[model samples]
Target: MYHYDNYDQTLVDERVAQFKGQTERFLAGELTEEQFRPLRLMNGLYIQRHAPMLRVAIPYGLLSSRQLRMLAQIARRYDQGYGHFTTRQNIQYNWPKLEEVPEILEQLATVEMHAIQTSGNCIRNTTSDHLAGVAQDELEDPRPYCEIIRQWSTLHPEFAFLPRKFKIAVSGAQKDRAATQVHDIGLQLVKGDDGETGFEVLVGGGLGRTPIIGVMIRPFLEKRHLLSYLEAILRVYNRYGRRDNKYKARIKILVKELGQDQFAERVEAEWAMIRDQLLLDQAEINRVQAFFQPHPYAELPAEDAILAAHKQCDAAFAAWFRHNSVAHKVPGYRVAFVSLKPLGIAPGDMTDRQMDAVADLAERYSFGEIRVTHTQNLVLADVRQSDLYELWQALTALDLATPNIGTASDIISCPGLDFCSLANATSIPIANGIQQIFDSLDYLYDLGDLRINISGCMNGCGHHTVGHIGILGVDKKGEEWYQITLGGSSANQASLGERLGPAIAKEDVIHAMEAIFQTYREQRLDDEAFLETVRRVGIEPFQERVYGDH
Candidate 1:
C-alpha cells in the first residue's frame, strides 16, 4: 500500500475541515439542500432512499490489515454495523448521519483514507486487479500505475465537474479481472513479444444507460508515455465530449459518434501537441513505483502433507479449493478468494464481525496485504497451501465459506430500490429470489457455471449486460418490469448480451429467469456452457418458454 506523505496529509486534513464547515452550515440552515447538494456529492455523500450514504474510497482496492480494521471500526461506529462494497471497488455505508459524516472523514484521514472522488463524476477512484501485486501471470504490479492515476485524477481542477462521471480501471493480469474493457479509460499492462512492457489503452468503454466495450486506441503504449497519454485522453474528452445530455456524455458515446478511427486520430493529434507538457513523466512514475515496491513474503515448503490431508478428508474443503484458489507467482503459496456472495446473504454486504475475521485471516494466513475486487470479493494473495485448512476454519466461523464460488446461486447483484433512489425495483430481493431457486449445490453445478447478474436500473451497477443471464429493472407505467439479456460475458471472448423479448413484471422476473435456465438445461448440447448454448441456440427458444408462459 502507498503511504501518504506530508503533502497528501495536509490536503486531506484541509478538505476535512472545509467539509466540516459545509456540514455545519447545512445543519444550521445557512445552506439550502440545493446549495449543499453538490458539496455533499463532491465529498461522496448521497441522499439515498431512506438516509445519507457515504461512499468511502478504497484507492485501487489495495488495503492493509490495519486499513481493513479501520473500515470495520468505521462501519460499527458510523454505519449500520456493516458496509456495502460496490462494483467500483469502493465501500458505501447506507445509514451514515449527515452531521457525522465530516467526523467520519476526519477519522479516515488518520488512516490515509478519504471519500474524495468516490462519487460526483470527477475522475472516480482508479480500480485495478485485486491480485495486482501478486498474480502469477501479471506483466507487472499494476498498483503503481493505479496509484499514479489516483494522484493525477484526484482534485483535478479542469475536470472537477465534467458532463458526466468518468471511471478508469487498470489490470496487468492475463485475465481481465479488472473489467478494463468496460471503463471510460481502460488500461491493460502487457509485455510485448520483444520483451518490452507497454500498455493496451482502450478508450470510450463504459456502462450505464448505454454499455459499450472500449475500443483499443493504442495497442502498445510505451511505459514512459502512460501519464502523458492519459492527460491527452482527458483533454480530448474535455474538449469535445458532450455536455448536453447526461446519457450521451460518456466517452463511449463520443467514440460512437465520431468513429473510433477519427477519435483515435484526434487523441493522437492532442498527444502530439502536449505529451511533454503533462504534469507527470517517467521520473514521476519511477518515484511512484518505488512507493509500491512489493513487500517481502516468507518462503514456505513446497510439499504440504497437511493441505493434502485436508483436501482428501473434507469434501467441502475440496469444493472450496477447486473454486476459490488460484496459482500465485511464488512456488509454495496460492491466492485465495473470499467470496462475498454467500447464499441468502446480500452480495458484498459484510458485517463488522465478518470484516474483522477477514482482517485476521489476511494478517495470519496471507501476508498483511488485502485487496478488494471489482466483483465485490476479497483476495488473500499470499496464502500458503499448508495453511488453507486453518484459514478455512476461521472463515467458516464467519460464515464466509459456502463453497458456491462461481455458480448459479453466486449471483452478482446491486443494492437496488433498497438503497439506490435511481433503482426501479429491489435488486437484493431479486438476487435472493434467484438464490432461493438455486439453493441446491448439485442443481447449481449441474446447471453449470452460470452468471446471473441483476441491476435495479440501466446504470449497469450490477454489470448486468456482461452476465450470462442479464436482468435489468425497467419502469413501466409506475410498475417495475425486468428485461433479460443473454450470452454476455467479461472475458477473453467479450460480447454484449442480446435481449430476449419484452420486459417481465417484477413478480414474473424470477420465474422468467427460471424458465430461461430450465430451457437451457433442456436445450444445451453435451454440457456446453450456458454462454455457448445461448450463442448456438439464440434467445428465441428461451423467449418462447418465458414469454409463452406469461
Candidate 2:
C-alpha cells in the first residue's frame, strides 16, 4: 500500500477542515439544502432514502489492517454496527447522521483514508484487479498506475466537475477481473510488438441507463503518455459531453453520439497538443513503482503436505479451498477470498466485529493488508498454503467462510430502495431470495460459475449489466417487478446482457430464476458453464421457460 506523505496528508487535512466548516454551516441553517448539495457531494456524503450515506474510498481497493480497524470503530461508534462494501470497492455507512459526518471524515483522515471522489459528477475511485500484485498471469502490477491516476484526478482543477460521474478501471492480468471494459476509461497493460510495456486503452465504456462495451480508442499507448492521453480523453468529453440532460451526460453517450472513429480522432488531436508537456519522466514512474514491489516471501515448496492432509480430512475445508482460494504468483501462497454473501445478510454488509476480526486475521495470516473486490468480497492476497486450515477455521467462526465464490449464491447487489432514493424496488430482498433458492452447496457447485448481479434501477450500481444472470428491479404502478438479463460479462469477453423478457412480479422472482436455472441444467452440454450455454443456445430457451405459461 502507498503510504501518504506530507503533501498527501496536508491536502486531506485541509479538505476535512473545509468540509467540517461546510457541514456546520448547513446544520446551522446558514446554507440551504440546494446550496450544500455540491459541497456535501464533494465530500462523499449523500442524502439517501432514510439517512445520510457516507462513501469512504478504499483507493484501488487496498486497506491496511489499521485502516480496517478504523472503519470498524466508525461503524461501531458513528453509524449502525456495519458498513456496506460497494461494487466500486468502497465502503458505505448508511445511517451516519448529517451533523456527525465531519467527525467521521476527521477520523478517516487519521488513517490516511477519506470520502473524496466517491460520488458526484467527478472522477470517482480508480479501481483495479483485487489480486493485482499476487495474480499468477499479469503483465505487470496495475496498482502503481491506478495510484498515479488517483493522484492526478483527485481534485484536478480541470476535471473537478464533469457532466457526470466518471469511473476508471485497470487490469494487468490475462483475466479482466477489474471489469475494465465497462468503465469510462479501461487500461489493459500489455506488451507491445516491440517488447515494451504499454496500455491498450479503451474509452466510452459504461453501464447505466445505456450500457455499452468500450471501443478501443488506442491500440497501444506508450507508458510515458498514459496521463497525457487520459487528460486528452477527459478534455474531449468535458468540452463536448452533454450537460443539458444528466441521463445523457456519460462519456459513453458522447462516444455513441459521435462515431468511435470521430471520438478517437478528437482525443488524438487533443493529445497531440499536450502529450509532450505532460509526458511522464522515468524518475516519477520508478518512484510510484517502488511502492508496489514484491513482498519478502520465504522460499517454500509449491505443495504443502499438511494443507493436502487437511483438505483430504475435512469435506467442508476442501469445498472452501476449491471455491474461495485462488492460485498466487508465489509458489506456496494463495489469494483467499472472504465471502460476504451469507444466507440472510445483505450481500456486502460486514458487521463491525467481523471487520475487526478480519483485520486481526489479515495481520496474523496474510500480510497486514486486505483487499476489497468489485464482486463485493474481501481478499487476503498473500495467505500461505501451510496456514490455510487455521485461517479457514477462524473465518468460519466469524461467519466469513462461505464456500461459494463464483456460484449462484455469491450474488453481487446494490443498496436498492432500502437505502438508495434512486432505486425503484428493493434489491437486498431479491438477492436474499436468490440465495435462498441456491442454498444447497452441492447444487451450487453443480450449477458452476454463475454470476447473479442485482440492481434496483438502471444506474447499474450493482453491475447487473455484466452478470451471467442479471436481475433488475422495475416499478410497475407502485408494484415491484423484476427484469432478468442473460449472458452479460465483464471478463476477457466483455459484453452487456440481453433482456430475457417481461418483468416478473416480486413474489414470482424466485420461481422465475429457478425456471431459468432449470432450463440451463437441462439444456447445457457436458460441464458447460452457464455463460457458454447461454451463448450457445441463446436466452430464448430460458425466456420461454420463464414466460411460457404466463
Candidate 3:
C-alpha cells in the first residue's frame, strides 16, 4: 500500500478542516438544506431515510492491518459494530450522526484515508482488481493507474460537477472479475502491437434503470496518451450528455443515441485534437507506479508436505480445498478465499474481532498481505501451503470459512432496504429466506457453482444484471415482489439476463428458486454449469416452471 507524503497529508488535513467549517455553517442556519446538499455529498456524507450515512473510501480495497483496525475502531465507537463493504470496494456506516462525521473524517485522515469525491456528480473512487500485484496474469499492477486517476479526478475544475456520477474500473487480469464492462469507463490493461503497455478502453457502459455494455472506443491507447484520451471522452460527455432528466443523464444514453460508429469517431476526433496538448507528465506516472511495484518475494519449493498432510488428515480441509483455494504464481504458495458469507450472516459484514483476526492472519500466514475482493469477500494472497491448516483453524474460529466461494448459497446481495434509502424492499432477509431453503452444501455442490445475485432496488448495486440467477426487488401493490432474471454474467463475455416473468411475492421467492434450479437440473447437458444450461436453452423452461406457462 502507498503511504501518504507530506503534501498528500496536508491536502487531506485541509479538506477535513474545510468540511468541518461547512458543517458548522449548515447547523448555524447560514446554509439552507439545498445549499448544503452538494457540499455534504462531496464529503461522502448522505442523509439516509433514518439517519445520516457516511461512506469512507478504501482506495482500491487495499487496507493495512493498522488501517483495518482504525476502521473497526470507527465502526465500534461511532456507529454500529459492523460496516458494509460495497460493490465499488468502499465501506459505509448507515447510522453516523451529522455532527460526528467531521471527527470521522479527521480520524480517517490520520491514516492517509478520506471521503473526498466518494459521492456527488463527479469522478468517484477508482477501483482496480482487488488481487493486483500478485495475480499471475497481470501485465502490471492496476493500483497505480487507479491512484493516477484519483489524483487527476479529485476536484478536477472542469468536471467537479457533471450531469451524473461517474465511475471507472481497471483490470489487468484476463478474467474480468472487476465487472469492468458495466462501469462508465472500463480500462483493460493490454500490450500494444509495438509491445508498449497501454489500455483497451471501453466507454459508456453502465447499469442503473438502463443497462448497456460499454463499447470499445480505444482498442490500444498508447501509454503516453492515457490522460489526454480520458479528458477528451469526458469533454465530449460534459458537452453533449443529457441534462433534461436525471434517469437519462448518464453517458450510456448519449452513446446509444449516437450509435457506436459515430460515438467512436467523435471520441477519436476529440482525442486527436488534444492528445499532445494535455498529456500528463511521464515522470508523474512513473513516480506513482514505483510506489505500487511488486515486493521481492522468496522462492520456495512447489510441494508442501504440511498441506498434503492436512488434506490427508481431515475431511473438512478437503472440502475447503475443493472450493476456496486458487492457483497462484509461486510454486509453493496459493491464494485462499475466506468466505465472509457464512450461511445466514450478512454478505460482507465483519465484526471488529473478526477484522482483527483477519489482520493477524494476513501478517502471520500471507506475508502481511490482504485483499478485499470486489465480490464483497476477503482473500489471503500468498498463504504458504504449509500454513493452510493453521490459517483454516484461525479462520474457522472467526466464522469466515464456509467452504462456499462461488456456489448457489454464496449469494451476492446488497444491503437493500435495510440500509439503502432508495431500496424498494429488504434484500438481506430475502436472501436469508432463500438460503434457509438451500442450506445443504452437498445439494449446492451437486447442483454445481451458481451465481445468485439479489439487489433490493433497480440501482443494480448488487450487480443483478450479471448474475446467473438474478433477483431484483420491486414494489407491487405495496408488497415486496422480486423480478428474477436468468443467464446473466459478468465475465469475458458479459450479457444481461432476461426477466423470467411477472414479479413473484417475497414469500414465494424460495419456491421460485427451487423451481428454477430444478429446471436447470432437468434441462442441462452433462457437466454444464448453470450459466451454460440457461444459455443453451434460453429462459423459457425456467419461466414455464416459475410462472406456469402464460
Prediction 1 TM-score vs. true? 0.96
Query: Candidate 1 or 2, higher lDDT?
Result: 2
Residue 5 accuracy (lDDT) in model 3: 88
TM-score to native of every candidate shown: 0.96, 0.99, 0.97
Cα lDDT listed for each candidate:
0.87, 0.94, 0.85
Off by over 4 Å in 1: 279-283, 301-303
Per-residue lDDT of model 2, residues 1-550, tens digit only: 8999999999999999999999889889999999999999999999999999999999999999999999999999998899999999999999999899999999999999999989889999999999999988998999999999999999999898899999999999999999989999999999999999999999889997999999998889999999999999999999999999999999999999998999999999999999999987778889999988888888999999999999999999999999999999999999999999999999999999999999999999988999999999999999999999999999999999999999999999999999999999999999998888865788889999999999999998998989999989999999999899999999999988999988899999998888988999999999999999999999999988889846
**Two-way TM-score contest, 2 vs 3, winner:** 2
- As a TM-score, model 2 comes out at 0.99
lDDT (10s digit) by residue, model 3, range 1-550: 6789897899899999999999999999999999999999999999877889898888888887777777888888888787877778888888888988999999999878899989998989888887787778878778888888887787798998889999999998888878889888999999988898889999888886898888898799876787888888898889899888889999889999998788888888999999989777779888998887655656878988878888988989888887988887778788899888886788888887788778888888876666777778888888778888888888888899989888887888898888788999888997777777666777878788898889999988888888898899998877898999998887779889898888888988888898888999999889899999999899999988888832
Point out the worst 10-residue segment of candidate 3 by lDDT: 291-300
**Rank order (by lDDT, best first):** 2, 1, 3
Q: Candidate 2: where is the Cα deviation over 4 Å?
A: none
Clashing pairs in 3: none
The model with the greater TM-score, 1 or 3, is 3
